[model samples]
Target: MLRTVSYHPVVRALAAHGLHTTVDVSRTYPQRRFTDERDRQYAIAAVRALFGDPAGREENGRFHCLHYESRPESR
Candidate 1:
């Protein structure tokens, strides 16, 4: 568990809201579509990348989960 007490403004803001844990979207329990789906998808992809999920792939040269690669313009 890497906890570096990030100094980045975004991290600080999220920390203020207790959004510290990685937003997991796994093969066993995929994140569901929500009203704020784009945000969730992006967060899930980021969490996958952070945790080194095997299904994470490169899309337009940027790294994200497989679903984001398939549905590139969801946002």
Candidate 2:
């Protein structure tokens, strides 16, 4: 059996400490498992909510990637 884990809470904690994060989504997982595009989009939305906005994004084959950098210190 395959189990799924969520890292959203950990990502949020990192963001709160001004750490950088990168998220990568793909249509397939190890062992030939697959995921829907809608699910990937939902993940993107969730990450964006925590990290604000991605500093970079890329699409490689069936993979969608996002990079989030620590925000600059406010004046």
Report RMSD (Å) for each prediction in the order shown. Answer: 14.6, 9.7
lDDT per residue for candidate 2 within 1-75, as digits (tens), equals: 111234557668877887656554432232321267665455446446655332233111122323334453455
For model 2, what is the alpha-carbon lDDT of residue 39?
Answer: 53
Candidate 2 lowest-lDDT run of ten: 54-63
- Using lDDT, give the best candidate's number: 2
TM per candidate comes to: 0.24, 0.31
Give residue 7's error in model 1 in angstroms: 8.3
The Cα error of candidate 1 at residue 62, in Å, is 23
Off by over 4 Å in 1: 1-35, 52-75
